[model samples]
Target: MTEPRTPKWRALADAVRRQIEDGTYPQGDALPQLKPAAEAAGVSYETMRAAYKALESEGLVRSVKRTGFLVLEAPGRRRVTRDTTVTRDPARGYIFPAAARPDEPWQVHGRPFRALVPAPAEVARHFGIEPGTETLRRRRVTSPAGEPPFQLVDTWISPAAVEDAPQVAEASTGPGGYLDRLEEAGHGPIGWEETIRARMPDREETQLLAISTAMPIVETTIVGTSAQTSRPIEVTIRVIPADRVELVSKLQRARTARWPVAPVKPT
Candidate 1:
């Protein structure tokens, strides 16, 4: 039996993927028009369009209406390490020690918006409250200096946790941010749990992140509990662009003494 030939679009997509991987179309480079690429690949215009769509789905390129397709930063190059440890400073609020560097100082522009909307099912569960229960919500977009936004965080706090500290609902929560305010309100975070997921962006997310709908995104849900009561005090949903950042987890194994060498046996 004769072997079946691969689909034209599939073959073209493979060729483009190779070029992207080999840095032929380096990051931020614009690809040729569909007609030109189609001629070069000796395929129909529709087939070339399919190939571009495939690249977009793979997150290798993005179509910008009139601007055509542009290469995206490869996943391997841009990484933002996230340490398991959560440290707090008297001057800075919550600090990710792994992400901080002296040369690239981080800048935060918080645009806090308050809402009394019903909590999402997952958020309600984390807060141990009934679904659709009204809660205080603060949405913030945080970014680093000279770069696009790092993440979008939507924090939901139980009314009891922020009753005494109304400032927590505002954009600027003094020096220590919301955690400090919560501490003063007698609901400090002693432990945290985070869940991470990867998926495509929604319409609003695409615009906010300045990315195409085809790009993948990382969604992290963080729950903070009180040290004294072990009750959930805060739940935050953070959305990060996959191309701009990477997540890392560090673990340290316990040390053990070396065992004595045994006599060698002939095989």
Candidate 2:
């Protein structure tokens, strides 16, 4: 029997994977656009697109808007080490354990974007209001230089609570950040509850994080609730690409259980 022939898309993907591994296209480098790349490989545009999709699923490359496809380089070197714990300092303001981690050099994509915008459905639900209701949304993006932008943080504040704390809407919510301000304004002793979720990102999230739609994202909604009254002060939605972060949790045993009598063996 004659040997089976490899499919065009797989062949192209394998070739590109090899090139990426061999450093032909360095990390953060954009691969050729679809038309030229497909022509060069003597494959159809659809074949090239399929190959790229496969590579994306493998976490090897990603589609970036306006920049074309980009090499992810290596996950090991880019992987961010994280701990499942929140750290805060009254003197230091936002102790960023999330994105812009202290271990690696990072840059805030831009200054915090402060605006009073209609709440997203999820955010509105958290705020106990109808969807599209006006709310104060503060946005920030943090990432390492020369890498895909990751960790888009959107903080939706309870408008009523911040009436007296005008600084909450300011460009810079002074020391200890807005949380501290809210606490000082009678929302004191803020407690946190986090709901973690994983799913494929939407178009906006994909472009913001510079990842392909094929990749999943880890979304963490950290809610700051009033410790005394149990009312949420703010809801923070944090988004990070799933392939690049290593989440660590240090679990501890609370207590030991012992049987009162000897255990019986099953037949």
Candidate 3:
């Protein structure tokens, strides 16, 4: 007796999974379009969608609107570094990190807005200054290419840091950005304090982010400190979509766990 044949979509998904594992379809690469793939396979569009959906469920691929089934990421375990804007590279020193791989690189969504504005309460607290103090507010929207904007960053830079590094007040701070300039201005050995909060977005935030009011946002506040004088130098607040990214924190052991042996005298 003949055995039951595998479903067309199931067979297609299995084939794709093999191709993905063998590097035939690398990360950021797109699979064939649904209609075309279905026609080529002599199957319906729904069948093709099922195949792609199966791959998505297995973390082998993802469906992007206006884009075909694209490989989400490479085959490996990934970790995220949720530091302040300053990412340390061995060759580059401190630089702003990219949100996506080279194939789909991150881009500043539009021209950044910079001006001296009254400090937010949290920024004042971090800087140990009076609320409403004037500070340079640098605001920018950023996202991966062809993707909806995911983050809005507002960096509040103290006047003292700007005074030390005049370039920090300029439109461009060379390649390494303000952190490098800050370090050059005798603020070496910089440290960071990060805190996270969650709340519903207001009208402006919802419109700028293009997310629904029902969706909450993740607020990450990073305070950069001068290790020498132990003073806060910069305070950056990042508003991010809650579901888009993973935030990881490193845990350090204060003391090792110990277990006592049973008393010999009792025995």
Candidate 4:
């Protein structure tokens, strides 16, 4: 018996996928119309449409009515190095290079969403406060220009921290942003602990991130402690679209190393 031939639509889809992967038709580029593509590929118009539909299902392209199919900027795998060193200035509390880069390609916009709600059990534990304590929550959606937001960060700070400095609760917190205000209020962060996990996004997250349900999300929890007092002052939860960004950490081996220790016998 002879082997079956590949479907025209599948072959067309594979060719388009290769072009996208090789940057021949870069992200945000519009693809040829179904009729034109069909003529060029020597296939029926319906076959070309099927190929485009396959690409859409794979998250490579999206079709807009009246408009042609547009390529999507599918996030490629990247290793984002985590900086362990804490760089601070008297004028500008803590400087995080990864959080905000001055020379980024895309423009960043931070929109604040404020709420005063009781702290959850995990949040309270991180904040070193009892559950149900009324906390000032500040949520910000950071996005690249003309694109879906990259991350949603919810910060919970003690009411006392923002008591003297009301600007901390406001939407616009000046040039230095929230951390600067916190430092001026005498609750600058001296140390922080971060825990990262991967999970599926909820409905609200899917809408805000503008991502499909199949996409996974990266959740990072950061707890910041006061410099003056060792008490926890801020707890921030960041939700990152896994397809858009990657988290990387670099660890150094200790200089004093011992090798080839004898195996321990039964105790």
Candidate 5:
């Protein structure tokens, strides 16, 4: 008898590629997230994740920490490399104002996008809603110009947020793109919290990210909250290829009163 089919992950990855090529998933459309796809494909979640990693290595799928996988380029789109800078200023704060409606094309030197439907568990856990609740999810890969993808980002928002901010519901063709609608609706948060972890990539991750066997992945979980209420509104997960990516943060107090009181001296 023929040897058992090469593990399910490879098969699943190939199937997704096939779907994308045949226009089943379509450009700008969300593909199924991992759990459901694994169940349908009759494989374990680990196996499913493996498949996605393979696609990622081939530059077909991108993994975001919190959001699921996303398809950045069309099935047959060509990727041309140019010397570019993937670094952002940590000390300088940049905001894409709501009114400008700036556009960033998907083919920028760094940053690739992956989109997928939310699974029931993810919807409930991430958005504080019941299973089956609807949401829009995207994962982004940001790398330094002429470097490997250094950052993986996953983002999720309630369907209501999308419905209210119709522009955000639309697929971004590039970067600094969706924030406009969120800011316009006054939903953008002033601060975010991040959690970090370190781990080695599995077989699929190793292949898809084209990472060396020795490299570890630095995983981060980020939650954005309203400046006023301090309530969490957005959650992001990012996985950085440890060899090529670095995470940077800068904190600035908004006012004097907001600063902590100093110890008193004896009168």
Candidate 6:
């Protein structure tokens, strides 16, 4: 009697791994044709394709139509960063107002607006604060000027500064944006610092962000403080897909006031 056959897809993936180890398909070598591999492995074309998918998930090979599978030279993670104007447009000569509150959880066009919960432990540590602290968390999904949402952003702010303002407290009932509240409270943030890092997403984050399991994430942690006082007040963490979204920060120099001195009397 003939021995039972192994699953075709798993067998194919094993063959590719062997090729890598033996240098038959050295780093950066093109993968063997799937059709031919199917024949060689005594597997159907569909099963062979499934094998390729497995390799891709392991970050072993990349496939592009007409390009076949190419072994990535370096097998490591990646991150992307872009400098965008704070305002809608740089030429407009206007600063982008700070995000103050959560938008109504209604659909704009077909896509629903987003919101965020308070900071988790790692996020809270970035801001030098305790977790579960009373902070304003905002979330939003933004699309290109005329496209579907390609990016998601979540930010956190302390209530210490804005609690006195009715509009700030009312965010729970309506749309609450941060910059607006800051302006109303007489202590608008004039400066900020942003720290970003690349990392893999956990299962829960992957579901919430709605990203592919194969993709990585870039996390941006921001600390916004009062420009006048130069004191830290709020810290925020935003997770973005590595493929989408760019972070831009433009800082202006603070001007020193020139106090007028009484003219000295000449003897």
Using lDDT, give the best candidate's number: 2
Error of 6 at 79 (Å): 12
Question: Cα lDDT for residue 7, model 2?
Answer: 88
Q: Per-residue CA lDDT of candidate 6, range 117-233, in tens?
A: 565786566546688665666566654343333445665555555454545444343333555556457666446677779888777555455444566777766677776456555
Candidate 4: 10-residue stretch with minimal lDDT: 99-108
Report, for every candidate in turn, its global Cα lDDT versus the true structure. Answer: 0.77, 0.79, 0.76, 0.76, 0.57, 0.58
Clashing pairs in 3: none
TM-score of every model?
0.72, 0.81, 0.60, 0.63, 0.45, 0.50
Model 4 Cα lDDT, one tens digit per residue, 18-38: 999899989878899989889
Q: Global CA lDDT of candidate 4, please?
A: 0.76
User: Model 3, range 1-267, lDDT digits (tens) per residue?
Assistant: 999999999999999889888888886789989999899989999999899888876656655568767775532322455544655665446554423443456668879889888987888888888889888888999877666677899998888887888887778878777888899889987888778899877777765765544456788777889976799999888887555666675655444433464445855
Query: lDDT per residue, candidate 1, 82-121, as tens digits?
Result: 6677766778778643434545676555455778889879
Better of 1 and 3 by TM-score: 1
**RMSD, model 6, all Cα superposed?**
14.0
For model 4, what is the error of residue 107's alpha carbon versus the real structure, in angstroms, after optimal superposition?
3.5
- Candidate 2 lDDT over residue span 140-250, tens digit each: 888787565667889999777668577899887778888888888887888787888998899988766767788888898888887655877699989888887767656
lDDT tens digits, residue span 216-261, model 5: 7876666656553455555666665654434343555766657477
Model 5, stretches more than 4 Å misplaced? 1-116, 119-124, 131-134, 173-176, 202-204, 212-214, 227-231, 245-267
Q: Against the true structure, whose TM-score is highest?
A: 2
Off by over 4 Å in 6: 1-81, 84-118, 126-128, 145-148, 169-176, 245-267
Pairs of colliding residues, candidate 2: none
Residue 174's lDDT within candidate 1 is: 92
Q: Which stretches of candidate 4 lie over 4 Å from their true place?
A: 1-73, 76-78, 88-93, 97-102, 105-110, 128-134, 144-147, 256-267
Q: List the residue pairs that clash in candidate 1.
A: 80-246
